[model samples]
Target chain A: MPQLSTFYHTLLRGRAGLLTGAALLLGSLLSGCDLIEFSPNETRTPEAYSDLTRKNLERLRQQPNPSGGDTVRFVFVGDSQRFYEEAEAFTQSVNQQRNVAFVAISGDISDFGLIREMRWVHDRLKKLNVPYLTVIGNHDLVANGREAYQKVYGPLNYSFEYGHTRFVLVDTNGREYGFNGRVPDVPWVQQALASPGPGISRQVVMSHVPPHDLDFDPQLVSPYVQALSTAPRVAFELNGHKHDFSIGQPYENGLTFINSYSFEKRQYVVLTLWGEKEFKLDTVQY
Target chain B: MRRALLLPLLLLASLLPAAAQSAASAATPDTLSLALAAAPAAEPEPAEPAAAVAPTGLTAQPWYRPHHLILQTAAGQGLITAGVGYTTLRGRVDIDVLAGYVPSKYSITPMGIFTAKAAYSPWTLPVAQGRWQLRPFSVGGFVSHTASSGLNNSRDGKYEKGYYWWSSRTRVGGFVGGKVSRVIGRNRYGHPRTLGAYYELGTNDLYLSSIFTNLGGLGVHEILTLGFGVKFDL
Candidate 1:
């Protein structure tokens, strides 16, 4: 609501006018510049995490666990891209492969996760043959986006398992306004990785802001990395938002953090976990 | 041109004999006796003059106003337009098609549009003569379908997508205006071209139903356009 009253209406006023002299002057100067997306080694706020996580965790305990059998391969995608277009393409591509049970989006399902974006994304995601879960990103907090996200995508921090693997989606995008020295809350994340349901052969953590990026706090990275590394089943930590592809070294706890590239122009990552420990990472382009 | 002049000249000459006959009858008793005897026969002679000047009002005859131009600004866009038009064979219905470019400040470069409109007024307001100048005004409704603009690659260094109704969209609205013409300088055709300024106000986009919500950096809005253009009757 603050952004609606503040920036959105102001933007509308800025857009109106018979002669848009001011907008024309301002828009021209800003269009050609390539602004920085993230700074170097920035840290998140050190403030205590909100009670919403605990409330979410308590609710998560009530949900039934997924039943597993043979190999279940569901595609992992990132970025909402152009909402419906991205959703349609992802659905079509996944359907072509068939047998996909679910989808996990890294983050940024909407540029500004307002109610409309929430509804739009929700409608598009519904087109998928399987239930899809989304992680929260910075851009998703435009208006009452937090409430909308919770209402549409369920709890921000929740875990669900399918067959032999477990998926933990967290809201690494901190408070809507500014960041402090903390992002991946160690206690909440530690609990999320602890898997309450049936034990799986692999564990994968999904978030929007990658710890490798400087925009994420340096303090939060160590604890997050430590948590993921400690899990032997945790073979991949898939994320997006750098708009580029990156693969980090095996952490101290021996975990691979793969930052997925932007989903623009049909880009996605396909991870094939063979048997129990062996795996292959393939970048699929359509 | 010389052949065109012969018809009206012949018509004027034909009226001379009738006028002379009526004059002779009015002056003599013998002529009056003959006039009374020939009254029914003489009736057709006077009706020819009325037919010669049949166009009685300003709006009665059609004028093919083939040139017009306009400059419009609204909703963060600027437009320049010009076009040509003509009247129907019956000399009452009028139609014109115009095209223009719309440049916006959102780095969405200029767009082009083509619109056609038609209207008719049964009678033109009487023109004031002498010190009593006649200020006539007429109101009629018109609808236009504007074409999407072509991409402009110069301003933003990118091709602007056309303003298809599916994309940027087009609007449908009604238009009304008044013409305050006190006849200006004669055009090359020798017809009095009226000069007046007209204003039109209208609403568009009745099909789209939008919900207004208060979101961070998001809000719903309606776009309204008000513009001034030259007005004349054809």
Candidate 2:
């Protein structure tokens, strides 16, 4: 009882101590709420960080195309996993570029597929002057990343059209699923590409693993490539995972696959597209 | 960035001396004598002679018998965790085994996390005439394995060995914490029966690797996780 009385007397002595105590309590409470994580693999994220893909797309719709004509210009990058320093510099570099409609990150938003990692990447990318988009990569699909990605970034396969260009992004990290063969969702890709609507002119496919890579599902490669090759007005397929820039027609069917530079590469691609199947690629060093 | 990393260390360093000072002052002979004088009157069941040497001799029970029960939440363990522990090394060290549960709402399926942890408390300060005690600092480490029916295997012969160097199901982490306890009664062994509340700040191996690789990019606080729990001396 005496100790209790003494403790109360000490607290009553100074306003600064009381204020410091109150501030510490408040700070711990706020940070504690976030730090009370169930597991690193937990898919749950705060509302502010969830459904980011949909939110970014919505934001993109509100801004008029920076490049006025029928041309759509965007910064293309990928594999942001664990490259926090690079992400910040990349943002600064992309923000300086003119006529960029948005930034498209092909995949691997997080290295470990952890919710915190995704949030960390978003913390950097959210500073962009233009909203950015991402597709799921093999690393993003690790552990419970598929559900985490779905919660934080919306569907794994989706298409959005802007400035007469239709962008089809899908999940092509098949090895993560043990090469389940159902991934890449070929039917969904075909459907998304089948109808570009009256306003759509050129179609572009984007994903994480390029079909030529061994990580991609070998069984679905034929059908997946055939789906893109036959899609109307399709310009090319863009991918990440390779961590460097390369553009080539690896298939006998004449489909051009363009690999993006990972964030660590200190480089990114700026693509300006106009008319059906016509596009220009420019690399920028951050 | 350097300042940010140094801030937490400075805060922790400042706290240690203040706590030690309070404990040193509270352990004065006057308080000890007063506590000793009041012990027998309040708890007649505890033998006076045995109570005098209880700190070292309290663990006369079987080695396999646990000395405390614990219930905790979060800290990257699970939604709810329950466990038992053995206290030894004059109550400075404790080894615990816990089983944690996370509902399906947080994952593809309900997860059961099993963890074994060990902690060392360098100081225990009795206050309020032995009615309360505070352990201002404790450092510990834990290893946990998560089991879920629906969790995809990171290494189920799906790739060549070392494709993913880290195991998805197993995690090893370390934590620092403090506890405050109130003595309610005396146990059969003439020891103070106490109930304590504690909080821990911790980070896992993966989080450490992320920060180590990107020291300038990630902040130390971003990797931390907090957990709160209660422990009862059995």
Candidate 3:
């Protein structure tokens, strides 16, 4: 009633109360949308929109396996930065498939490293029928991005097991850290690369910056590459920052690396795995 | 939180009738509203030219000096920011320099943002109650720089030329909103002063670009942010 009276007062003052109400309503509706930016650099996402990486991992495990038994098949895409429209299309395409267990985006989740961008990508990707995963990108390291990424996703380096495969996600954006030499965290990579006792049939590595990219620490390249080449039951490495599709053995050490297409490419990849060191790559255009 | 928000609304509601009653009794409305609004602390005002009341020797401060003290939050500028600015263009333009902070308790690195904003208010309408002046429309933009800007420039040439294009430190955006100001009383120097409550809806350059590039998929409300503030004109 008082608001109604304010509406009357606004008309008396030449159109107010309803206008005020509209403004107020819009504000309250978008209250948690990060539109009222405290600062573009701060990673102040609400609880509902945070820790998504871990949550998606749990969602990945919930999918029932087919009678194909030991085989694991999933979709791969990358670089959702500012490609919200394409992200929707990607999600739509990924949802139509029946055999896929999850979708992996190889980093550059946000273009500017802002929390809003991370949340925006999540808002689009969450519509998919399967869970999606991402590694940290160089772009995600800008400003307070490292902190923001930690808030929305989990650690820069984490590992999860699905079926017979062990997926290891690493933070290889060393140039962002001024070539700290500690990054790529050789010790951690070496430890994770070690053969886990039985039940883990295949080891897959993923990161944002490709091993051949200049952004990876020059000093750590040899060790980083050697770790991958020698890792037990290791398959091909996966990455995204390049925004295109490519598969090659850059080191000539028999270690293969595969790069996925960015959201804007109107394409994505699907990996079907069965048995040790055996896989098939299928590129789908949406 | 709800009660705190309603407090201001209730105060505005209660003061209306009192102002209307005083205005009805006085012979002249403007002088009467001014007098009643500034009443509790001073004598009833008499009709007189603003210039004529000026006493010799005690001159009004120069125009370039800041006309008000401002405290604000949000609008993508800062978490909590404070600054002072001068109004110009017949009270239509306001320029402020603000500094904002976020403690290490929340962020891994406590962040600081320095910003400058210019707002233009095109109209001010007097409410039926008290000395409230309603600014029905205000529009403006701001540029902010964060201390930890590391978006485009790699730490040690880690990136090749044209790698990441956007600057993480510098942010640009625009906002629109309204304000309510009341003639509380006079300052110690006998200068008429006002207290205002204002709000703005805003979006930064990156957010705007995201909307622009994908217009159909995004909404203006998605890009917009909100800011609330209070200012005391001296």
Candidate 4:
């Protein structure tokens, strides 16, 4: 034991040994606790990186709405998967915008549903001037992604209210579940959309796969869409996974669905909503 | 799902006793031959003189026997990993099989990762008068399969073929590392047994793909994973 201690001390005493020790220390610091990843799909995350949805919501609650009117304005984007350069630029662009309350990402934050991928996206998104939130996507459910998403963000389906709006974020990637009839949790969405607290003027639903897409469960489509259309003060449903932007009333009931631009598109929509379903869409290219 | 989880546990359970038995019966002269090749005059005096009596010629052990045992953590393998390895080519190459575990807290369910790895070290420098050894550089590759009861299969029958080209359960990765070892004692074959500590910097296939596709977007450091371990020569 004495020899071992002396050996270590001798090794650390030399210039080369000092350099090696310094390099190791620097590497550990640079990688943070994330350097020792048990698995790429492992759900463990540092406190700062975990429960982001809740943290972002808390941050949003603390910051007063920049638009002082009865209006809510948020930058909408999605599919930031592996788009690190674009995310940095997106953050810079969003920071420059005035009166933006927050950023809403529809889904698909990580291409591989890996913790590091989510952390990478967060590393950039955390730089934005305003708080940002995310919904779980099909990619985020890959392998151990469900747990990873729950650990890194908060939940697969969650709702938050800010600036007179109730945002219902749900998981709609049915194919990932083998088209199991339980996905999108129609009952839960209905429950969330059905309740609007005081000062809540409109409801905005967000998810990854829209009902029309093949990835969505065909069996639950009618029930899921019906839940949204019948909900009172519903503005429009927001979706990603298509990687492009589209807005239409595909159903006979005239329920509007607004698709968002993926991060790689170098564009995002700024949605300004007020007075019930009245809203304006402005596209900003970074 | 239970069967998938059980397989790695069974494999791990089966390997330990076999490694212990091999270590017990490892009286063959081949161990000395490799030790001599590694360190010609580095032999430490034996604590048990009865175990040091050796035949002159190199007699090979059973092919299935491993020369060393390994325990490691991280590097996207598992929280704790244990394995056995065979060193060959005068200690320049090592081939190993390992089983690793991550608890339910870190995943949807407790996960079992089974891995096969091969490493090559081009240089082994004697340090501190051969009482310690330094392998300055090692390049290696590994393939691992993860089995968890609650893991959602990426390639399940739910999607059309090629929907997701990569398999979430399996990973192929490469690493570069260095190791430092100290001679511990003499084995039955009169070889200077060593205990070594190592560190590996690695990246998996999905990480490689992420960085390859986003050269300007993701930095090399972001895709890297680090693992640390200790190896004991039997």
Candidate 5:
């Protein structure tokens, strides 16, 4: 007995109510997933030592240093491909040669610095009968990356002297948390270069990101360039970030810098320190 | 009393002769066959009134009839996008805004959007009902836009800050599908309802494309929901 107008109004109201309810439910369901969004870690965690990290570093340090120094030739390579088996094969092949002193991986030891990559790299590097050293790369800074790097590779900015040559490795990834600076810890390199070991005849700096690479931090380049020019024992600088073979000769002051490319040539540089002030660059093919 | 009885008997006797004559004629071979045929024919003629009744089925309506609207949100590579869209038999149109986060300088401040886009579908098909009321297949077409925003940086060495708005994100695509529907209605106080399965493909909404892009490519996917309380004109 309802009037025609009343029936239409009731039907429309019911339809609208149902539609509005559906919209509300859809909105909530969609927005709920959005609420669980991912935010990049803003605060950087200081790389502190841990049991596993310390154990890994000690394992690397424990590898035997050869007794006699008869023209010690170490391979300086960086940015190994992602395949662990390929890298392990390369390491084993290099290990078979008896004259090689030690292997110094410039940086990007692990593409992501994930525990898996670090472990894989470590296990593969263990195949070598010689000692191996690594520097930190940009990819190693995600999540607990620095901690993982220091745990697996040791003090990232530390120096080591082997058979008259002093090698200074530093963290060049900078604070990529979108900080105000251009690059990271330049002063550390300056001090490291200023003080080489007692009988260290040659000094060389190695890092993942090259100072001359287009993707490099401009601010960090000047101070690093200054350190390279002033250091008396400094020979040629070795670097690998460009992923391709490139050489730059920056005539800043009096430093003749040689910026090496990536693992393209299956190659690394062999520096022969010819006593206190002179050295020779021999690009070794592995 | 005797005279009245006699009058009634006289009337009955007079009517009995005519009745007897009609019965005799009906029982004759030729007359009986004709009478039987006439009776059946008369009965069947009354059935003609049924011819005016309307056939019970769905109406021949256009396929563009849309029954729902959808919104999508996607964020990736330091960018976030929010979109609102309307779908109908005619077509669809959507507006989207993108925003980026700047965590270094401040937590709350967004670097703003590097890109923003708005898309409009000029023509759409009523492919939903094609697989249902008609055969099991339908097709449709739509033209759309997909713009990009340029990037900006505040300082030479630091984080970039700027926005780029793209003009031409236009594209065209088609969809083909089948739809099936079922109506549920209780006669008590409400109208009937419809529910069923439907699939559409084409140059779809940008949000769907973005999700598919994030997933690698557009393949098979599902967005299931229940619809009730629909109205129609007879």
Candidate 6:
């Protein structure tokens, strides 16, 4: 009986050793495999995926031969939510165009606002021949979408100037915040519009939720629209949440608001600007 | 707030591995099955008397008694999750229900998920003098409903039908893995109680769809997550 007990103990110890080995391997494998996700909205991304705004800006800034900072032609599009097939077509269409300097998306980068959806859009948009940037959208603010958008695209409200144009990307999705009255950051927009660098000829504001839409905070609409209308060298405001193509002055204050079609529409607009308060809009179908 | 949400999960995790609860349950199972019973290894044969005692006619347990309790992390279910399951079909199939938690960050609120899982294991090898089992392959799937804000299953009346597609609250995922268990002695309820550790590689419907659409770019591993946990007979 003693011998049998000893043999059983030996077997248990051996099995324990094997289990330990397997556990160790599993530990290492967990780290190596990207599949071990903690949550769908989890915020772990590689260096290349994070701080994308800085990366894209760096790419834009490091161009060697400079243009005369005068005529700027760029692709303006929006609401690229979960339209992979359309995104591919959009990219192909944009690449074929001549003299397009970068691209702008109005918002709604992801439908459910999951990190996976943002990454999918980014992965597809990354294929564009020219550098592209986006503003935060209502859909992008869903769940942990605000964080995911900020992490992946940089800031909800940020601005950069290239070729006599100061592109100010603002967060205008007030309804996402239950109309807390602080969104659209009127003060920030006024300031950015107030101070365009020397020789800048135009300013274009872009956001997902347009001021005219009910989603925009009604209380702050006057202040927001006023800032844009009064801003220096204001050309036109671009938006994307409508998923349709519309170009008009919603407030009829001589301030133009251009809404880009969603990727599913298989059409995008190319805006060409040459002088202060002067622009041309062209739509391309993919 | 985050700490408060996770406090219960941490407590459950700490209470799962102790096998003494299982031992005490052999005498009175009512408390063991209902309470957070951290069971100890059931040693069927007395160490010194090895082959001497072969007790007869152990009482059979009610069919509804849980076969095991599971505590797992990741697998896209939660940062920490716990569940109870019943094993059937010659102990090769399991059906479980898990409650999982996810911590909040930024604008996203912390959420809890309810998951129903079923697994089928085709082969189990008995080793260690018939006191242990090694299941090399376990295949299963789960339907999890995320009880979180903003993951809406239906759109408001303002939007047209199919305005926004895809179900946000419900998710279907599948996993494949292996388990190693140690057999304990029979309980008074006439059932073999075993303690096991398992690991699974899993992916959800959305991830799988992404893989299928972008097969050239995405790898099977990119969409998969690992779920490891302890399982014990109740």
lDDT for model 5: 0.45
After the best TM-score superposition of candidate 3, give how far the Cα of residue B201 lies from its true spot, in angstroms. 0.5
In model 2, which residue pairs have backbone atoms overlapping below 3 Å?
Answer: none
- Per-residue CA lDDT of model 1 for A1-286, tens digit only, reads 5853455454334212111233333334433221110000001111121232343334444533322353555566777734455555666676665444555678776554433455445545556555566788765543334544554455777776655667788777643323454566768778877754445777778898877765466667787787777755676788877766778774555567777666564766666653455566666666
lDDT tens readout by residue for model 5, B133-152: 21155454434222112211
Better of 3 and 4 by TM-score: 4
Error of 3 at B22 (Å): 29
Return the TM-score for candidate 1, rounded to 2 decimals.
0.43
Q: Which pairs clash in model 6?
A: A35-B224, A35-B225, B18-B38, B18-B39, B19-B39, B19-B40, B20-B40, B42-B184, B44-B185
Residues A1-286, candidate 2: write the lDDT tens digits: 6975576566435422232233334334654367878888887789999999999999999999988778999999999999999999999999999999999999999988888999999989999999999999998877788888889899999989998999999999999988988988999999999967888888999999999999999999999999999889889999999999999999998989999999999999999999887889899998
Candidate 2's displacement at residue B147, Å, is: 0.8
lDDT of 3 by residue, A1-286 (tens): 6986576565345222233344445555566666566777777888977898989888887877542767889888888888988888888888888788888889999888788888888888889888888899988888778989999998999998887889999999888888889889988988997976688778899998887888788899999999988889888899998999999888878888999999899999999988878889999998
Full ranking by lDDT: 4, 2, 3, 6, 1, 5
**Better structure of 2 and 6 per lDDT:** 2
State which candidate, 2 or 4, has the greater lDDT.
4
lDDT (C-alpha) at residue B71 in model 1: 30
Best by TM-score: 4
C-alpha lDDT of candidate 3 relative to the true structure: 0.75
What C-alpha lDDT does candidate 6 achieve relative to the native structure? 0.73
Q: All models, DockQ values?
A: 0.01, 0.28, 0.26, 0.37, 0.02, 0.28
Of the two candidates 3 and 5, the one with more favorable DockQ, higher being better, is 3
The superposed Cα distance between candidate 2 and the true structure at residue A61, in angstroms, equals: 1.0
Q: After superposing candidate 4 on the true structure, give the runs of residues whose Cα lies further than 4 Å from its correct spot.
A: A1-32, A195-198, B1-60, B186-191
On DockQ, the candidate that comes out on top is 4
- Off by more than 4 A, model 6: A1-14, A17-21, A64-69, B1-21, B25-65, B101-114, B122-139, B145-170, B180-193, B205-223
Write one digit per residue (lDDT tens) for candidate 1, span B9-36: 4433433453454346456434323323
List, residue by residue over A1-286, the lDDT tens digit for candidate 6: 6975565555345443334345544654675345666667665665667788888888877753133448788898888876776777787788888878788989988777777777767777788777888898888876567778778888999998887788899999887776789998899999888968777888888888889998899999999999998888888889988999998876868888889988878888888887898888898888
Local error of candidate 3 at residue B81 (angstroms): 1.3
Tens digit of per-residue lDDT, candidate 5, span A1-286: 3674465454334432333244334434553331121122111122321233344346545645443542346666777634444465567667766556777777776543333345545656767766677777765654334555655556767776666777787777653334435354777777888866577777877787766654466666777787787886787777766665555576656565555435444666655555654656567565
Candidate order by DockQ, decreasing, is 4, 2, 6, 3, 5, 1
Q: Which stretches of candidate 1 lie above 4 Å from their native place?
A: A1-70, A175-177, A195-198, A250-253, B1-234
What's model 1's lDDT at A57?
37
